[model samples]
Target: MTDAPVRTDPSERMCPSTPKANATVFLGMITPAGRVAYVTPPLAAEVALAGLPDPTEATESRYRLAGPCVTSSCGFWTGDHCGLGERLVASYQETGVPDEAALPRCAIRRTCRWYAEQGPAACPACSHVVTDAR
Candidate 1:
């Protein structure tokens, strides 16, 4: 089979917990509860440096750029599948977390790998993972 092209088109949406860099397009914020809160007029740069009236440091492990497409640069990818998504699903099952919850109102759900691979079941667990919640 032909290898999937390394996708780099900006995602229509992004996951908050995913590691992001300053150059990433700021589309949304992952609330403390793990729900994604989208920005109406997405910031062109990191929120911490957006020069807002009350700018706060983009805490090292807190917020990062998330978008609507898969990042081949991510270490979790294996061909067209996301290894992290698989592990997240398995972790949820091992923890006895029920996989029957309403899908989150995610801006990137349509293009999210976890959502695509694990379906609605991945949402509940997605909230629990952060770029640096440890």
Candidate 2:
């Protein structure tokens, strides 16, 4: 018996809440309800950044971004999977954990690091994550 090899290709895993320095896609905006109002097809991060006239406004607080997963370099990496994703799923399990059918429509899911490792369980938790650059 052999265990399947873990997929570690950086190109195939996206960080759904990356900082501006690493962001490639503007995933969504956090709405008044505090849940992410996801971008359906995904927009280029630069396009969104270019339109933001307020240089003083921090992008992380209002927008969710996606970028290549910096697995080991990321604080959320737990060697085998995302520690943050694990924690989020674990926390939600104590409450009403959404099923795969409830997953939100968003770009990068095919390659999202959390979704890849944690499956549909990551979506519900991810919808509420606001990137804290501080």
Who wins the lDDT comparison? Answer: 2
TM-score of each: 0.58, 0.84
Model 2 agreement with the true structure over 11-88: per-residue lDDT tens digits: 668888899998888788899889999986667777776666774574788889888888899888888788988888
- Residue clash pairs of candidate 2: none
Best by TM-score: 2
Judge candidate 1 against the unseen true structure and give its global Cα lDDT, from 0 to 1: 0.53
Residue pairs whose backbone atoms clash in candidate 1: 11-68, 11-69, 12-68, 13-67, 13-68, 14-66, 14-67
For residue 124, give model 2's deviation from the true position in Å. Answer: 0.7
Q: Which parts of model 2 are misplaced by more than 4 Å?
A: 1-11, 53-55, 95-99
lDDT of 1 by residue, 41-114 (tens): 34544533364454455542444445443457656678777777778788887545444454545445555667
Every model: Cα RMSD to truth: 8.4, 8.2
Error of 2 at 26 (Å): 0.4
